[model samples]
Target chain A: MIPLDETDKNILNAIQFDFPLDVKPFEKLGEQLEIKEEELLRRIQRLNAAGAIRRIGPIINTKKLGGVSTLAAVSVPEANIDKVAEYINQYPEVSHNYLRPDKYNIWFTVSADDENRLNEILEDIEKETDCPLINLPTVRLFKIGVMFNIR
Target chain B: MKDIYIQLLRITQDGIPFTSRPFKDAAAELNISEEEVVDLIRKMQSEGIIRRFGASIGHRVLGITANAMCTWNVPDERVEEVGKIMAGFSEVTHCYERPRYPDWPYNLFTMVHSYTEEDCIRTAEDISKATGIEDYKLLFSEKEFKKTGIRI
Candidate 1:
């Protein structure tokens, strides 16, 4: 974990709740934190480099943006799993994938413009890979939200 | 060098409150107009910067049971087909393909949820049968270390 200073923790906490929407958002944040914008930038960079944060960007809800999204898993032979994962990750539609302890291990999220297209991509993958596939569409969204407690 | 992106990322992940005039209330605290807040959120959404602005409920509070992450070892040639079949399940919330590590045996992954663990297991069994893959395993989350939005 990154060793964060008081200012860094404050910055992280403030941003998690209310991200300003302005031409100079960071400047706004700096004002609230009573720090220089440059300092804020430097701190974030340092934290990111230390793996305290994965990414600093927009978290779009593809479904709200008129796209179909679903979580998918594939089971590839141990020897060829890496090769297969590389192929699947090549598509822009895929967001995150992980290896878990299960018979069917490669897990990833797919988002496309439409359900039909999403299905098409899945089929294409199936035909190309010649592997049995399982498609788990979201039946219901029970809880889909994130909370970052900086306090 | 202040990176404004970090600030933006963190704020969005925390989520906006669900209120009659959430933007107005939030803006008041920030000393900004409600319109300004609305415009900013709109732009963020249009740019694919913020995924969504809504309430994120706790699944445990909702009495949801039987959540398990399942994986499979699919043939190189038929990975896509098997993935699509697995994704077709309504009970599935998440599914994906990731690089397989040497120590890790399973490759494909999917998540299933039902009223009970037994139900989830049953669903997994059905999926295995439906997809025609014999070798598969289910791993349930033992503990949640930190399940929250990542705002860096």
Candidate 2:
């Protein structure tokens, strides 16, 4: 892992939320960090290449965009986990899939444009995987955001 | 909302181009002024349709290898109180109240991130101690099957 300095940490923290939207957003960001615009851009590029910055962009609210989503879990035998996960992952709606340590070993969040599309994907997965799945849709979204202090 | 605004969203769903004049590039493609694109984005933020404009990081690549979906079986009467407490923690990134199922009694879910598995477990224990809710379980991700932002 690349060791992050104070400047890098500050940059990461600032860019995580409310990144400037000006013609020269990086320049504005550099002003906040007390660094040169060129240097800031270079560091951001390096960070992106290093896989630290997954993507630099606007995070659209899926629900606001008329998408129906739910958290679902399934249990696959140990031997068929990879194959089953691969099959489930083929659906574009099935995002944030993970293998958890529990009876419901495979958990994932799926999102689709509408209720019909969402159910179609779920039904397809259940039939293909031949595993009973549980759907745990969020009744109330109290909070949804992730920000880590690099410092 | 105008058709132009929807077009802009389509252009930006993946991300803003990584360039100095990113908005300008977007405007050029849509045959609109850069100022208009910025104005629309600003308007969207004010409307709460866009939560925040920012960069997403690979937390695992940054040494945050452990994550747990900590579920709490808080009573219906106290779910709101306990949920607010859980949501207050910096380590608790996503917190929600979901419907309980048969043989699955957890009603509250909180996603916690830590540098190690021990740290994650400790966070879960600390949450329980703070909330005074004994019925809880920590589900750690043994493997990441897939992860992608919701596409509109």
Candidate 3:
């Protein structure tokens, strides 16, 4: 594990949810974190290089951004899981595909520009995989906050 | 989203650069003032189009290795209540209520991230006991083929 000092932990905690929307946001945030803007930037760069920070940017609401996404699950035979997952990965719309130990093991997300596009992509994937896929669209988002308490 | 904002989203999808004058780059690319770019960001945030604007963390990098999708078959009446209860836990990162398939009765889905599988089991059990929901299964991700999140 990449060792994170107190300042690094504080920086992650401070900026995970909101980066100030201002002309000089790092300056304002640095003031709150009691660190110089340059030092904070240096630390941010280090953390980012270490793969601690995946990206420093906006997490757009895909659905609100005029697109649709659904969490889909399909049970592929053990031998076909790899081939099916590799096939599904060809689509840029798919994300977070995982193999879990269950009947419906292959779980993925199919996000598209619209409902029609989403359905078409799913149908094409199902036709290739030859496994019935269940689309579980989120009816209500209770919480999506992903603030990690870096200790 | 307005045409102007769509332009902004495409430009800023990689996120604002890490610099003193961060928005200037995006603003200059879009041929707008930095102040205007910030204003559009604020507007989109208020409109709920920009869910969040900050660091996207890699939990595993933070020593959070084990993660599982714990799906609960919450009763229709208790979905909202159980959802809140489940989401209140700091360990639970994502909690959502989705449709219950005929063969699969799990409706309330939660993502639990922890340090180990034992921690996940303990936390899931604690959650089940707290909510009094018996029918649930913990689906641990054996291998993550893709997790780079959606791009513009």
Candidate 4:
């Protein structure tokens, strides 16, 4: 486990929303927390190693990136669920996949460069997996984004 | 540790309290001290089990330009390297490798964000160039019926 002091917490909280777009963003963050850049980087690295920080990077707006996103579901035989999932997991288009206790047992989110490619991939998966595909793309995007609170 | 971590996930997925004293209110509901809740959250963050405790923004309201899910046919030998490289992009969110079906030819998947569809396409093209993977697919979101953090 990683040890976090009040300063570390403060630094994390400050960066979550206000990650500066500067030459040395961490340096600015360190200045805010009254800590050395080297020390702050060290702490962040330690926290990441401990899994506290999954990543330290900019959060971009994907929707603005000119692509389509969708939540797709597939009904796979229980016996072949793992195999199918393994196959689905091999694609980079799939963002998240889960095994739900529903008729649509396997659900995942797919984002692609365009609508055509997305449909093509889905159709391919359906044909190969021998499982029916239910393409439930987002009709309305309700909400998206991650919030990391320090306190 | 497992149980507590699950509880933490449940709490976050259920949604953080939307109040000035959100932690205090959450503690009250869970029958724990506010201080305890805060401590637990801190611990969870430090442990990396809980990546971050924050808000889920409304992209539509913010007028996001575009977003798409791009899948690549990464060789099994270089899956990890490609995944790491894809994750390095600030515009790419939710990068993971899913299994490919006979019908589903591509394997590496990444979600890219931009201000417009053209931008997303350009980014995907750039990624294609960078990764040197010619065969891949792009799936755009048609509708988001329900999107929420799982409470389990």
Which candidate wins on lDDT? 3
**What local distance difference test score does each model get?**
0.61, 0.84, 0.88, 0.62
Which docking band does candidate 2 fall into?
A: medium
Q: Give the proportion of true interface contacts each model preserves, from 0 to 1.
A: 0.10, 0.77, 0.88, 0.01
How good is the docking of model 3, as DockQ?
0.78
Give residue A104's lDDT in candidate 4 (0 to 100). Answer: 54
Interface RMSD for all numbered candidates: 11.7, 1.8, 1.5, 14.9
| Candidate 3, CAPRI quality class derived from DockQ | medium
- Each prediction's TM-score versus the true structure: 0.48, 0.92, 0.94, 0.51
**Count of steric clashes across candidates, in order:** 71, 0, 0, 71
Candidates in descending TM-score order: 3, 2, 4, 1
TM-score winner: 3
Complex DockQ per candidate: 0.07, 0.70, 0.78, 0.05
Query: Candidate 2 regions off by >4 Å?
Result: none
lDDT of 4 by residue, A30-87 (tens): 7878888888777766655555654433233344445677777788888988888878
Sorted on DockQ, best first, the list reads 3, 2, 1, 4
lDDT of 1 at A141: 36
lDDT of 1 at A135: 68
lDDT for position B81 in model 3: 94
Q: Which should have the higher DockQ, number 3 or number 4?
A: 3
What are the per-residue Cα lDDT tens digits for candidate 3 across B48-140? 988888888877988889999999999999999999999998889899999988888999999998888999999999999999999999999
lDDT of 3 by residue, A14-133 (tens): 889557888999999999999999999999988888888877777788887778999999989999999999988888898779999797999998888899999998898899899878
What TM-score would you give candidate 3 relative to the actual structure? 0.94
Worst 10 residues of 4 chain B by lDDT: B143-152
